[model samples]
Target: MSIGMSFGLVFGLTLFDNIAMGLPLGMGIGIAIGASLDADAKNKGKTI
Candidate 1:
């Protein structure tokens, strides 16, 4: 999933910037996604 997101981000950003900038942006997005999933996992089956 990270690889796919990275590839998509790279492809999308390639139109505006170089691969260098796209790489970090993709990584940041992937990390954000992972973190959100982790948060959801931690809260699973719990009452708020």
Candidate 2:
């Protein structure tokens, strides 16, 4: 979330734009990626 906001600012976006656009997008993507990895780990454990 902070990463995304920083990136937006670095790229010349407004502060409001950073929060409105970056935070939710970054957090959602992060959550999806983490969920995928957790599911993969569980599957690997089951196989083993």
Candidate 3:
């Protein structure tokens, strides 16, 4: 999610200084979390 990406970018900038690494890492985590949420929502018969 964009939220995660932004957070990651900020975190990376604050802690490390690697925009490239931070963006992808954050994107991956966001996608995984989003997928999990989506699956859970679908199982619960809800729309996300």
Per TM-score, the best of the predicted structures is: 3
In the range 1-48, model 1's lDDT, one tens digit per residue, is 486467757765776567766666677777887777778877895433
Measured against the true structure, the TM-scores of the candidates, in listed sequence, are: 0.65, 0.56, 0.77
Kindly list the per-residue Cα lDDT of model 3 for residues 1-48, writing each as its tens digit: 887798779877877888987898788878888999999999999988
Every candidate's lDDT: 0.69, 0.59, 0.86
User: Taking the tens digit of each residue's C-alpha lDDT, what string does model 2 give over 1-48?
Assistant: 455445555444454544567556666666666677789989888541
**Whole-structure CA lDDT of model 1:** 0.69
Candidate 2 residue-pair clash tally: 0
lDDT: the better of candidates 2 and 3: 3
Best lDDT among the predictions, by candidate number: 3
Q: Give the true-structure RMSD of model 2.
A: 5.1
